[model samples]
Target: MKQTTVSERALVLAPRGRDAMVAAAMLAEGGIEAVVCDSLASLIDGLNAGAGFVLVTEEAVATADLRPLSDWLAGQQEWSDLPFVLLTSRGGGLERNPAAARHLEVLGNVTFLERPFHPTTLISLVRSALRGRRRQYEARARLIELRESETRYATLFQTMDEGFCIIRFVDGPHGPLSDYVHVQANPAYERHAGIPNVVGQYVRQMVPDEADGWVDLYRGVLTSGEPIRFERELIATGRHLELSAFRVEPRERSEVAVVFQDVTERKRAEIALRELNETLERRIEAAVAERQAAAEQLHEAQKLETIGQLTGGVAHDVNNLLTPITGALDLLHRRSADHDPRMARLIDGALQSAERARVLVSRLLGFARRQALETRATDICSLLTGVQDLVTSSIGPSISLRVECSQDLPPALIDPNQLELAILNLSVNARDAMLEGGILTIAASHVRVDALEVSGLAAGDYVRIVVSDTGTGMSAETLARAIEPFYSTKEVGKGTGLGLSMVHGLAGQLGGAFTLTSAPGQGTQASLYLPLAPGVAAANGLSSDSTLMEMEPLNILLADDEQLVRIGTAEMLRELGHVVHEAASGAQALNRLIAGEPIDLLITDYMMPGMNGAALAGRVGEINPDLPVLVITGYAGGDLDIGLPQLTKPFRQADLARSLYRLFHTGETLPTDCA
Candidate 1:
């Protein structure tokens, strides 16, 4: 297509010979482009050539045929009404002359000037006419842009995934804004909301049972000029929708633009997940009860052995189930780091459920006395103060919690995590015992234990942690068997019967003794007596200060049978500035060591095909006797006498860092019997 170009120059017409030439020269001197036309026919040709405005004398129009000029004026575009400046004699009064008046009517946009006018005045009039013509050209450009914009909007409206609609508020006989009339709707509006041919129809009329609140919601947005986003179930459509609504402006009549998406699938998934967690919790409880029942049939010594075996098997199975769940949730948590707030909350909920399951498994293992303990010197006063808020919240608002610790209390050697769990378990038990409101006190004090003051402990310094509750006191029989597994006086399904037993086992594992004192009328007090750690200051565990230490990166051999575990662990090691070589099996790891792979440290899973971690370490020992080895295991209970430092599976990056720091920074070595 040939494009039309609008000219910026003026067209001059004058029947008097020198008048037209003189006008063109004057426009030229004023920096305006002008062309001289000899007759009406030439003037029409110049108009078709896109002149900005016309300059002509009264004599030119009076002598020329007027029909062609009138036709040209009528044929101009809607946006273009070419300006015409008419020069007349000073006393001529063109209004009284019928011929001149008729010519003026032909030129739709005409400006008159007396012939004796100032040159500046003529230039000013010409400049004003050109400015008006330029505005018309601008209007034409804007119209073109508007047309293209509308085309793009139409395409987006038709193809968008979310439903979109614009509705103007409609007045009823009762009041204004009683309902909204759908003025426009996209294809997705019908598909997602299931309302068809909705344009130009009032909402109440289309959906007769539509909630009045929905109408009021849009009305509120219109009045407040505020946008709202929410999720709701549409009763009419039988679908869950996430809606975002905003007021459309020029709001004489209230109008709203709504964007919505059907989230019924997401809603269903949330419900299914909640139900799955409940089912899993019930299964775990039932399994624990079943194992406890079987152990009751055995002799006292055999029962402990049988329970240990059963606990290990259950722990292994549970760990297998939790491995992928925790791993996948960890990956999901990382992926959703920058996701929307709602998605982040959903991921956090899933992770919490997985963590609860892990805690349940840990409790079971603890009750069986099979869970491993990772003990360190911990300040008793600091640990109590840290968990004060948690303990307070765990007990309802009806109960009061008090924490008291001696200022000079020494550090106790214990596993911080297990001790926290034990204390939390005791607090919950106390809460349950108190039907009404009561006071729960957690206090720590330094005490000296004489001979036989505590079982399996010599005379030395100790920190005594006492958890006392002013709840319903337990009977003598209840107190005597409180530490026995599956022994509970609470109603069925209300208690797992393992809380106290787990706490007792945790105390024993930490080289501490747990004792409960209670009577029929008085409240109960559960005490944990832990030997003080020697040569460790109370500030050591409580201090948050850390300094970055420079250390040389080591060449490490990493082995795991599980691909995901291996990849995750290897990434952690590499992030810590170590060079890692991965092997899928013990045999492969041993082969690498034997092949002189120059491994400074060897980390291998305890269980693998062809040869186990212990066997592989034994072979590596022969190849390089001084090579440091760390064993990683998912097993709940087993002899860790391989004499190598062992870390439990599903450890965090910090855990790996600490282990490496202890092995390298402290110049520690595995026992010589690490084979």
Candidate 2:
């Protein structure tokens, strides 16, 4: 405890008699605290705990082991150099005594005070040693502060997101400060520059061509001691870098620090946007015109779509009304049977007028695209030739007619009746156009077409039928709306606008196209392009015996929502010698079968109230899979794909006979001879 108190001042070690006590008294009188250590271990312990200087006698360590003291002295801190004042005997200095020299070597920072020396000399040496020890503590404080600052710098340099690098200018063969080498880099250096392991890379080796620009830019910052911020492209790596550079302190080292980010994509988008704006003014007018035209076409298309839907609904109702009228009229005509000549003539006129109504309804159905087209392979040249006489009569005596059909013209896949009607309509229009007497030409030819040549048809063989007349042609405005339903230029009663529309609708329904060309002064030409039928034309092989075949009575169920249609249809069926059971709706029709009624054939109107004909057919399939079902539809029956025979509404007894013959004899389509 005493030695620990004294260790901050001086430690006294003197094994010779009265020496230790004397040195202690001398240091105490000089206002210095001192502790007397009995052995070398105590002195070493005092040195470890804390001490300013050591006062020791040469005799104390002369015969004692000094390795412990030597070991303690060797292990001092960098800022520590413990001072020692040695008390040597007379003539026992380092030059004359080898042991004394060895002691001097082991105990460094020592001052020798010989025996019998003056008290003033001893105090002066001890005070000087204490002053030297105080300076070492100040040095230790400075070293600690320096290390902490370096640690903070290292942490920030490695953790920043911006790519950072330090480059030092180097003299090269080119000139002074011509090149630079990367001395340090952060973790983000590789990401921004796209170059890995770049800490030791030289500018010349990394990008030789770009080295001069980089060196010159950073060199300006280094020389001028001003921070520079700019963006530039690195040619070798193909990167655009937004960079900020500043000269580090002590510019003589010629080092610069840089922080950067990659800006390649942002720069490219900016360039593209600038280029688009430069040319936008030149294209605005044409773009608006095209958009206006598209809007008009779309408006016309939507109008046609709405009209087609309404027409289909109206056609369904009209067909239902026409059914009873035609049936009653035909029944009346047959019952009269020439009882009176005047009565037969009146009935015939009424029948012909009803027939015209039927034709008009069919044309409406065609325009609506709801007509069930019976497409077949027919020779187009023969079809054109067949229509020539009718065309000649319709044109009257003033206009001449010409039919020029090419030889070996291919058969087209189309509904022959619809094609005939379409050609007749075209001839009528031509006749009307040639009021002043002009030539009307109808030409038929086989033409091969690619996809781009036709608007609607794909690349294939087609039969083109062109009808032309030398007459007052239509203007561009009239030609544009020529195919729109209910649009006409003729006096109100002179023409129905649906003629061209029905032809156009038929072409679309049969997968074909109708085109017209006309000018104000020149004659008009109307062309119909029908696709060539696949393979060869199939013959309608109805047996001659089928013509003489008699139809046996069918135990039939007739279902209809309209009472008049059902009553008229049932009477006709009974007149044909078939017993008919009637139902008001599809549900009632289905209930008859479920109730075990004797029903050999089920004939139901396709559109009915509670359940539709297709739904009723599906239900009937579960009850009697083999029952021959005949579907009668006022609406379009083409969508009814249940593999049942269909008879369109307002059909005569002959049409009904033909449909029934097909169901009984063959599931495939039969010839019209059965009718």
Give lDDT per model, in order.
0.80, 0.83
How far residue 25's Cα lies from its native spot in candidate 1, in Å, is 99
Question: Which segments of candidate 1 are over 4 A away from where they belong?
Answer: 1-302, 316-372, 448-450, 453-461, 536-558, 562-584, 588-602, 624-628, 636-639, 653-675
> Model 2, stretches more than 4 Å misplaced?
1-292, 338-349, 535-549, 637-639, 666-675
Q: Candidate 2: what lDDT?
A: 0.83
> What residue pairs are clashing in model 2?
none
For each of the candidates, the C-alpha root-mean-square deviation to the true structure, in angstroms, is 31.5, 11.2
Report backbone clashes per prediction.
0, 0
The TM-score, computed over Cα atoms with residue i paired to residue i, of candidate 2 is: 0.56
